[model samples]
Target: MGKITGFMEYERLQEASEEPQKRLKHYKEFTLHLNDADAKIQGARCMDCGIPFCNNGCPVNNIIPDWNDLVFHGDYQTALDTLHSTNNFPEFTGRICPAPCEAACTLGINEDPVGIKSIEHFIIDKGWENGWVKPQPAVVKTGKKVAVVGSGPAGMAAAQQLARVGHDVTVFEKNDRVGGLLRYGIPDFKMEKSHIDLRVKQMEAEGVTFRTGVFIGKDFPADIINWAKETISADQLNKDFDAVILTGGAEQPRDLPVPGRELKGVHYAMEFLPVQNKVNAGDKVKDQIMATGKHVIVIGGGDTGSDCVGTSNRHGAESVIQFELLPQPPEEENKPLVWPYWPTKLRTSSSHEEGCERDWAVATKRLEGKNGKVEKLIAARVEWKDGKMVEVPNSEFEMKADLVLLAMGFVSPVQSVLDAFGIEKDGRGNAKATTDGEGCYRTSVDKVFAAGDMRRGQSLVVWAIREGRQCAREVDAFLMGDSVLPR
Candidate 1:
């Protein structure tokens, strides 16, 4: 540790950002990173705890203390290297990951946690600015070839690792562009797409090929998802590639099937979020769903719901309200009881700061509409009794809602892809695959592996990267009878 008593001397500092009103006008990232001196101060706050629980808390197990010490000593290049050792895309996690590491901080039992995420953001951005990040193309070419189906974080991480190990890798994406979810599902105001594009370029230089607008499954209708422009059969991929990894996202949106569910203005959060991304990318979208001047109601209280609130505010909506079925958590967690673990506590996102009315323990009963468009929402207060929701007596209410967005989260991956390949599925409809033992990450079908959302169900981007890296190792060993890649 660079400063033995630094944790006692320094308090945590957060990254600065634009005023919500000012930032609401444009679809660009608003949060700013910490400068060098501020970052060093933050790094110095890392305590000399014997066991680094923050590492275990992080999904990728980042070498947090090593990087913190390096940053405190002004050895930022080594800090960047240490940061990249376990995580393939720190920039993505730095921006979007809900840092469980902070929750598990040793100092956080009483004091503020170290600003680890901000330090990471600074380190990676510095690496980019100094051109330290480069293509690491393998010198010796292994004859093995791999097919990674999905260009999200998991697929990208797998492809990069395998390519660096001298294996020929190709990534297939059904969308017009790469970055399956990051390209479309995410709003630009949080993270710009250029980050994904830059990585794609680097991967290409490292001998990883990307095929966009190519669906490796049965044909879908023109109205469904990114609508496969071309189809590649699973049989063809099995024959061509030595191994295949399924890293596609969970895209099956959970639907709200109450009365008047088919109203024109009511849509899934995916149906609304992706249109703005496409428009931002200079592509013309058909019949775009906008929140401008409409009274909006977003259901489900999660990151996706928060995203809807932020996007709706940006669209100049008349009003935006979000509903949560669960009871509101306490404002702060009981640290003594939940230390070194993720705790259930109230968290308000930057989007909530921008403005959105939020209510908990409220469930939508039905939607009322006129002229084939939603006009209002009918809901009621709910109470948990004996582990079940029971509506409060005579607590029914109505609110004006010109548009409704269902942000209830995904159910599973689109079943068509799994069905086309005849891969077995878990009870939850995710790809059936183990995460440990001799056959880890290998699907029931030979030479076919699954990882990320496709295998483990919907999860954070950090988990996706971890699974991708590990799956790459398994696939490598399967092809060559051994592997030097890290687990």
Candidate 2:
């Protein structure tokens, strides 16, 4: 550790955020990064814990203590290097990841955790400002070709790793842009699209090809939502490339199959979120689903629902309300009982802080509307007993809702893509694959592999990156006799 007594001297200092009232006026990132001096102080807060559980807490297993010490000593370039060695996209995780690493911090047992995320944001931003993040093109070509489906974080990480190892990599995206969810699902207020664009440029410089608006399995019977200009068959991809990696995320959103679900105002969170992102990218969205002047009800208490709340507020909604089926968790977790592991606790996002009426243990019974449009939502208060929800008698209530957004999270990947390639599926319907031992990440079918949400079900960006990096190594080892890429 750079400072032995640093933890006792400094308290945790978070990055400053723009005033909610002012930030709602525009779709730009509001969180300010820590200055170098403040970042150093934060770095000094990292204790010389005999074992760094924070490393294991992170999905990508980042070397947190090393980077913290490096930053504390004012060696920012080395800190950036250490940070990037494990995680391919710290900027994305630093901004959006829930920071499980901090939850497992040794200091968090008694005091505040080290501001690891803020320090990471500072390091990555500094690296970009100093032009330290550049292309690391392979010196020699491997004379092999790889095809990566979906341009999400997983696909991006795999493509970069494979390209750096001298293989020809081409990333195919069904959307009009490179980033999959990062481009569409996330709001610009949380993370600007320019960050994705910069990484795309860097990957291109590293000899990875990006083909947008190209669907890999458009011929399937199921109608997949894509804006692809061309359709490529699974057989064609198999013949053209030595290896194919499926990274398309879980897109099958869990739907509320209740009365009036067919109402005009009811929609999936994906249907509403992508349109706003498109508008932010300067594209004119026709008949966009706007929450302006409407009583919006966002069902499901998760990140997506929180996003809906923030976007609705930005759209000038008359009111925004969110619902959760499960009971609210304790404000503070029992740290001793759940130390070194993610604990269940109440998490209020920035959107919730802005303005949102949140209710827990409330379930939507049905929707009542007229003229083929949703007007109100019927809900009930329920209690959990004997591992089941029992509705309370005389607890039925109705609320005005001009629009309803279902944000209950994804169920699985688009089935068509998996079926089109004749890939085997697990019990959960995700592409069946393992993460360890011989033939890791290899699908039942030959020469095809799966990673990210496509293989592991819906998950975090950091986990997706971890799966992608490991999948790339497996693919490399399968293609060649050996691989140098880390697991």
Candidate 3:
């Protein structure tokens, strides 16, 4: 530990954020990074716990304490190195990850946890400003070609690792740009697209080829959401590339199968989110879904729902209301019972802080509309008894809703790609692959592998990176009989 008694001396300090009113005017990152001194103090708060659960708590198993000590000692470059060792994109995780590491921090049992995410954001931003982040191209070529389908965090990480290890890696994306979800699904207000651009540039310099607007499947039907200019068959990819890794994320959104779900104003969160991101990137979106001056109802209380709330507020919605099917959790978690683990408690995101009427334990019965457009939502109070949810008697209610955004989360990956490749699917419809044992990440078909949401279902960016790195290692070993890449 850099400072033995620092945890006792310093209270947790978070990064400053812009006022909601001021920040709502533009689509840009509003949270300011912590200054060096404050970051050092926050880093110094890391106690010398016998076991660093924060490391395991992090999906990518980030080397937390080491970087904290480095930051405390003013070793910024070393801190960046340590931070990047396990996690390929600390900037992404620093910005969007919920920081399970902090929840499992030793000090968090009794006091505020060490501000690990803030310190990480500081280190990465400083690294970029100082020109510390650069291309790390391999000196020798392996002459083996690997195709990574999907250019999201997982695909990007796998391609980078494979390229760095002297293998030819080509990333295929169905969108107009390299970043799959990061470029479209995420709003610029949370994290500007420039971060993804910088990483794309770095990867390109590292000898990784990015083929955007290229769909990897047998057919590119007009019914699909792919904006690809060309289509490559799965058979052709298998023959051309020595190995193929499917890192495509789960895109099949869960739908609310209720009356009037086909109404004009009802749409999936994805349908609404991507348009705004495309508009932010200077692309013209036709008939884009907007919440302007409309009473918006966001169903499903999760990150996606919160994002809808923020976006709707930004669009000058008359009002925004979020609904949750489950009962409300306690504002504060029972720390004694869930210490060193992710606790079940109410989490208020910055979007919620912006302004939203949130309700829990409510189930939507149906949507009523006028002339095929949503006008009102019919809902009922639900009570959980003996692990079953039952509707309360005569508790039916209705609310005005000109727009409804379904944010209940993704159910599975787009099945067309999986079917085209003849890959086996799990019970959940995700690409079936084991994380351990022989032939790890290997799909039912030969020379085919799966990872990230494609294999494990919808998950965090950090987890996607982890799966990508491990899958890359598995692919490398499958090719060369050995790999130096970390798992």
Error of 1 at 325 (Å): 0.5
**Which digits, one per residue and each the tens of the lDDT, describe model 3 over residues 1-487?**
9799999999999899999999999889999999989998998899969999999899889999999999999999999998888988889989998999999999999899999899999999999999999999999999999999999999999999999999999999999987778777788999898999999999999999999999888655442366888999999999999999999988888999999998999999988998899899899879999999999999999999999999999999999999999999999999999988899999999999999999999999999998999999999999999999999999999999999999999998888899999999989999999999999999999999999999999998889999999999999999999999999
Alpha carbon lDDT of residue 237, candidate 3?
98
**Arrange candidates by lDDT, highest first: which order?**
2, 3, 1
Q: Lowest lDDT 10-mer window, candidate 3?
A: 218-227
- Deviating ranges (above 4 Å) for candidate 1: 219-224
Candidate 3's TM-score:
0.99
Top model by lDDT, which number? Answer: 2
- Candidate 1: global Cα-lDDT? 0.92
lDDT of 2 at 292: 97
* TM-score per model over all chains: 0.99, 0.99, 0.99
Q: Kindly list the per-residue Cα lDDT of model 2 for residues 1-487, writing each as its tens digit.
A: 8899999999999899999999889889999999989999999999979999999899999999999999999999999999999999999999999899999899999999999899999999999999999999999999999999999999999999999999999999999998999998999999999999999999999999999999898553332346788889998999999999999988888989898898899998988888899999999878999999999999999999999999999999999999999999999999989997898999999999889999999999999898999999999999999999999999999999999999999999988889889999999999999998889999998999999999999999999999999999999999898999999
Which whole-number lDDT from 0 to 100 does residue 51 have in model 2? 93
Model 2's TM-score against the true structure: 0.99
| lDDT accuracy of residue 105 in candidate 3 | 95
- Model 2: per-residue Cα lDDT at residue 467: 94
Say which prediction, candidate 2 or candidate 3, comes out ahead on lDDT.
2
lDDT of each: 0.92, 0.93, 0.93
